[model samples]
Target: MNLTPESKVLIQGFCEFISGTHVAQMQAYGTNLVAGVNPGCGGQELHGLPVFDLVEEVIEQFGVIDTTIICVDPYDVLDAALEAIASHISQIIIITAGVPPLDMVQLLRKAEACETLVIGPNSPGIIVPGKILLGTQPSEFYTPGVVGIVSRSSTLTYEVAYELTKAGLGQSISVSIGSDAIVGSSFLQWLQILDEDETTEAIVLVGQPGGGSEEAAARYIAEAIDKPVIAYIAGRQAPPGKSWRQTGTLATVIGRDPNFGTAQSKLAALKEAEVPVAERPSQIPELLRKEIKIN
Candidate 1:
């Protein structure tokens, strides 16, 4: 499925740390880097691209940008995002910096008010196959295909998509839904999109040991969707009271139970609703093959 035509993206707070990595990967995928924004590095060149002093400067130079990838420091995340919104340079914002929880909440509030489609406070950005690579995912892991992928971890998203592609499956859209607790977008949001896209025949959801997002998506599948969903939840045996490595990995502990119940519960719910929950990562391809053959 094709994304909206407006794919040109501004890389916000581009600096020595992430500029090279992001540019090389995204350029290989055919995305244009409209401009780079960094306060003090305006006149300098990075990887042969001009760096601007601010988001406003970038907008003035490059016109309005449809997307912005925020790769600034955690302390500067909110300020950087506000700058992007003020310039009206981005409708879709992907914040790759991992901000503190309190800071993330503030950012989310501002994001909602601006009506911008924010991807993460701690995400690896997004990839649309031959279109754009907004973050650091290896460009070789993706190709044009029919399965839509949404995941909480960037690494896992890359792994699943790479494995799927190697197994002869391509993705319609692969989104790494940043691990921040209060980040923007949800699996259900993407689910609706994939459900409507004729190219997307199946969906692969990668959930981590955390919040109710997976469970929420499971409920949505149970109630509204008929397409086959294959799910794999990480950190299945995480200890209670300690946050999982990623944001949103919070499960309530009860007595002797270690909250492994959460993932299992969601898996059980999906299975009950007739959505196929993969018992292991290796099973995903075979399951998809079987479903496609049967259908």
Candidate 2:
């Protein structure tokens, strides 16, 4: 929470030649990248940050790593995250996509056991504009404000943030909390965080068809959340019992298909809970203005 210009960050899979431009970009944007981890690539530097062969080596050198961003391959994501956790890294943000669900499940279990917060295996990551960049979220699409945005889709999180920023309804934090069915965290967790965040005056939830997360969020909003929750569940037109790029079909595939997470069912739950639902991303700002009297 105490994000500073010098917050210590360690890149788990920092490459020298291939990823120099990216690490430099992050450094340019005020990301305090202290070190990187790449087996057999130690004693080297990328973007001026030292590279370590393992997370333990980085820990031994740097003392304490505040946050670690996992950039390893999907198959290696679990091991990378585990290494980070072993090094007592409190917060991990996994940017690697396409990690097997079972692997994520195992990783999440381990993370939970250690009381660590893991952001994503398939996520764009979290960004608080003018403050911290935990993942790869573009800062141009973000603006610091009272609205808190949480979403499942990586692309749509940016689209919604762009819409809000354009409308002058800047966001406190915009994050893609992983779109895979068996993700580390859920809307409920972020909802609670945003609820407690004093800067957040309103909440924007961008959910997609296929997971019970939306339905669960609605239930929580109805019961606990006091802030005005503007909701948008994407993929309404997605064909049922079919795939829509890992979004819509997760419920059935994961064998946790709540009758409520389907397109129609999800929308109904939100409406039933009196959460204002937007039909499209562009409509979100208008809905926010109407609901929270913003911009």
- lDDT of all the models against the reference? 0.74, 0.81
TM per model? 0.88, 0.92
* Segments in model 2 whose C-alpha atoms lie over 4 Å from true places: 1-3, 15-21, 248-260
The per-prediction CA RMSD against the true structure, in angstroms, equals 3.0, 2.5
Q: Return the top candidate by lDDT.
A: 2
Clash number for each model:
2, 0
Clashes of 1: 2
Worst 10-residue stretch by lDDT in candidate 1?
249-258
* Local accuracy of candidate 1 as per-residue lDDT tens digits, 1-295: 2244356677777543375766876776677777777788998887657888887887777786788878778778788888888876445455554576787677678777877677886777777776667778777888888888888887888889888888888887788878876777888887887788787788889887666788788889888767778888876675644566666543354663554436666666677767777766667888888777522
The residue ranges of model 1 lying beyond 4 angstroms of the native Cα positions read 1-6, 15-19, 93-95, 239-242, 248-261, 293-295
lDDT at 214, model 1:
80
